[model samples]
Target: MKASHDLSGLVKFLSRDDWAFHFEEVMGDHFWPVMDHFDLDHEEINDALGDHWAMTLWGCAFEDFLTQVFDPGGQTFVEAYLKRRSWKESAQSKAYMTALGTSVMSLYEASEIVPGKSFLARDLIRGGEPVLISEGTATKTLRQWERVAARIVPLGGKLIIAGGLLPFSQEASDALLEGFKALPGKRRRSRTQPLLDDEMLRAAAPLFTHAFLFDVLPKALGETRPIIHNSDGDEIVFHEVRFPLATGITRKDIAWRLQGIPQLRQENAQFWNWLDERSQKGPLKARVPNALAAGTTMEDGTPVLGNLELKGRFLTLMVNSAARAARGREMLENVLGKMVGVPLTTIQTIEQMQEARKGRTKEVDDIPLEVATPLVHAMLDKQYREILDQPVGMLGDISPRSAVGTQKGREKVAEWLKYLEFRSASSQNPHDPMTTYDFGWMWRELNIENLRR
Candidate 1:
């Protein structure tokens, strides 16, 4: 179905000033409260390169583009829903329901969701008590999950919404998407609102590419297609594979297990290469996506291993086809369970493991980031020093200060600045999103690329 909204004119009216104010004023009006309620720490919404407003910049400009272009479409579902439902008496309620008409709302927008709290976690009933769904199964539960923009994109059928990657995290969003995917197919719920059709989405995709939202939603989501298809229309199917760790096995134990397997060994090598590239700092991040890896444990007892990016004991795999995913799972089972003597535990899909992790006790081990990470109230200053700027002697024996002297030093300094910017940019820390990191000093000192207003 065609969008009744005039998306073409969406960008026509949005000038740099509109965006500067949107993130600073409009978004801040809606965004900050949500962050506070969820205990999500953020300094504030800012346009670092406010002076550079060419129609040509890449990362920052595209981010602003999403801030503007996605407003109408993101509001489509809830706006239509509000039309069908009875209007509430409270003026505040009226504003909450109607707000989606122009802005993308998220968990942060939860408080003013009018009649219903839009930020509350809703569930999809897949036979028993509400289960966390698989990748693309059930986009948004009519009752459980509330952020329409967050849930819809992954279901391959859920309605489109205004929010993009900025407010919510990419990984948590992906996990939610997978939960929707894992829902039993026969009982899947039809979308609450009409989906923006291929024609509309095709027109919409460029807005994403130009806005750089594409960095979050890639063309090939494993083997799955976006519920809203893009024009590039690459016809491929991706499957998520998982091998659950035994009760006692740690992610650190994987190296010993893979000591003899040539294929997995090769795969492990490729994963690190991708991690190294992902960890590199620079403007544009000049990086591909972070390679998802499954490590049992590190030999050194290092709490952090191979980049500190593992998702606990569960090693999830992403392959193109179900057949390949199945085969890979079988191979891992044979290699890990039968040959290597890592005692074959019960085999389950990543979604199944995730679904089950829902009910475990606090003492029981559960998904690292999901069940536990939210409670972490570590000092921002400490994490900033530990994770972002720990220590690197790239210029022999000099700080970023001394390096700015020579041409080679300046180039190295640029890399350091870019690394800081890129890391803070791509960081998905739910507690401390990259936005919370204050890179204002470096931005001024480096005199890097000027950002669009």
Candidate 2:
């Protein structure tokens, strides 16, 4: 299939790998080399760069560049192209253009400009300026431009539109659109698939069984500060409450909400000490470095630490946004297949449910385990709530970036799908029952206790 149309699968397929992914080729005729005549240092030349620089060099963002290039413009394709570049570079109020203009022009002809500088050539033909790509014959960094371009464009509101060259045989654009279209529906109407097929009790066959519990996990128990009891006469301590009854009960659901939990900054020395102990065991693998570990020291120069310092209990606030469903699903599959430690489908389902619940209407069927999942699932979905934004943070504050994606938050739909897969696959069974590896104490913590609280 054309690379442009194959974007859906390509994105999903690529996400299974590390953070850095290459999409320059997938861009096809849509992109052109921006540095055809630049005098860049070897290091900058060798690194991956995003096409955004090219766009910026042309005096517009990626999308702006596209509209201008594809739509009718006066000058000869070359003149218009150079005109745009001059404008783009000048807007930056820098000498990047004048300093490298001549070099950029000469490189496009597939001829060397400066001995050790670089060269570039147009590959794909779309509208006016042929899409310049790395001919590889040049000594400069070809890929770096694309890499930088990718980061800047997406982070901004504009989408890095690409069409044509697909790695596989597919209408990459259509597939991408299909996935994009599906994002909202999935977010609005969560897709809940069964975790297992019922099997009769046998001498030895795996069967699924789930347990539910509810409790208030006080910060003090973990060697942190105590929660402040409100003026109400209700209890401050979180007792081991029963199921179903506990399922819907969030901190907000409680009659007299537990109050006065100290902010992480106020966390007493005990918290820091706990972090130290946990750090000594090993790297204390975490999403971010352990700050507490760096703060405190032990009696014999020994350390104390609370293995995983939680920032806050997961938040489940309703949000209004747009998403691409196909992308969400592909993201789920990639995450699951790559992060073997976690399940995929479950999280997706949970995200779908949460998005649906945010709306006034109910769209999808309820899974048998709906009541069993934590209340957070009703809002943020499992994958996003737990994985993307770790249930654990510094001690009551989530990172600013953990919120939105299309804007600046985590992709909620993808996260929920992952969570669903995690919860479902981890359910206990009769013969081959679930173990800590599948449903560990932490899982239990997610389901029952007042974690974020």
Candidate 3:
């Protein structure tokens, strides 16, 4: 029988008069957060989260109830259910139930997932070696770096997660960690400190459901949008501002003028990069004899602000925001003078750009997979090689190379790597070259291959 069947049987037993109050208490604790947060009633929760998540919420609560201690002696709903229904359950079911009674609910980070087979679960709330979970269905759907709050119980010598599995978003996971840190009776020395003792985490398990719902509900209810923004914090809107060459002006004239500008770096005959003069001069340099001192800024650091290209009769500037397009237009006008005519602009949001790409006709001479895969891989290799030494916002603005120098930074880097791998694997097209690219080399290069597990 499936685990859900066994859990349902136990739930039926718990509905009896003798155990109903304990069941209600656990259910209330789990549901109250979502209800209170949205000012929702019991019936409205199902409407809000929909059937799938509502059932998931209930399953999580029921599993949490299995671990609850009812009295000072520590009797639990699982014990009560097994006492009345053990004879009806199979040996495996009985063992599962017995294990659930003692299991604790905690957040876990999944890694090395083999769809329809198994995955490793590293406890985020309680520090320990990762446990291998012999899961089938969840593994098929779970992404790498996905966090879930669940109970990992050993059933017949192999570890299996209990029926209640709550998948958490990154925001929810961070909130849950913060909630644990803020709980009374224990003080955490640092944000990276190991989680509270097992009993404390278990007692505060409802916070897991709360945090998950807090992040999920707003989006589910259409209260938020998945907004993408540029590093400047402006919503991303691609702008292509084109200027026609004035009567006698030619591409050569514009190229010559652009070459003389310090902010524009010519890439080829037709393309130039518009650079930001205000970007930081890379990371700090270490002080040494006859070397640059720490905190001393470099002279040649310029981040790309936009791009310029000469196509046919037009000089085109491409930027990610309207503000950048305006500034780029002014700069080009001041330099080109009567060499360029009045500008024409085109704007597209990310969604519009995606739709435009989908609507475009495919090239007749498409590259073969064998040729394309290597080219794409080569491009990605070059991109990531530079990324290794560049600051990543996710890693607290520290470069991955610098991050690996400390234990805490290494942990963050590992998580960041998992996210990159997961996103690559989740690419929409199965045949996309990115989907097949191996990130194992990245881990090895960073000397954190062992942590890939």
Cα lDDT tens digits for candidate 1, 58-163: 2222323343433544433334334444232244333432332333222211111212212222222111122122322222222111222322222222233332
lDDT of 3: 0.77
Write down the lDDT that model 1 would get. 0.35
RMSD of each: 20.6, 27.4, 7.6
Arranged by TM-score with the best first, the candidates are 3, 1, 2
**Which pairs of residues collide in candidate 3?**
none
TM-score of each: 0.25, 0.16, 0.78
Computed on alpha carbons, the lDDT of every model, listed in order, comes to 0.35, 0.24, 0.77
Task: Determine which window of 10 residues in candidate 1 has minimal summed lDDT.
Answer: 296-305
Candidate 3 stretches with Cα past 4 Å from truth are: 1-5, 72-74, 189-193, 223-229, 236-238, 246-307, 330-339, 348-371, 382-416
Reference-based lDDT, residue 76, model 1: 38
Candidate 3 per-residue lDDT over residues 319-409, each given as its tens digit = 9888889899999999989999999999998788898799789899999888898899998898788889887765777789999999988
Best by TM-score: 3
Q: What is the lDDT of residue 317 in candidate 1?
A: 56
Candidate 1 lands at a TM-score of 0.25
Q: Kindly report which residue stretches of model 1 are placed more than 4 angstroms away from their true locations once superposed.
A: 1-238, 244-252, 255-315, 318-405, 415-432, 440-453
lDDT, candidate 2, 250-314, per-residue tens: 43322122122211121332121122222332111222221111212221222221111212222
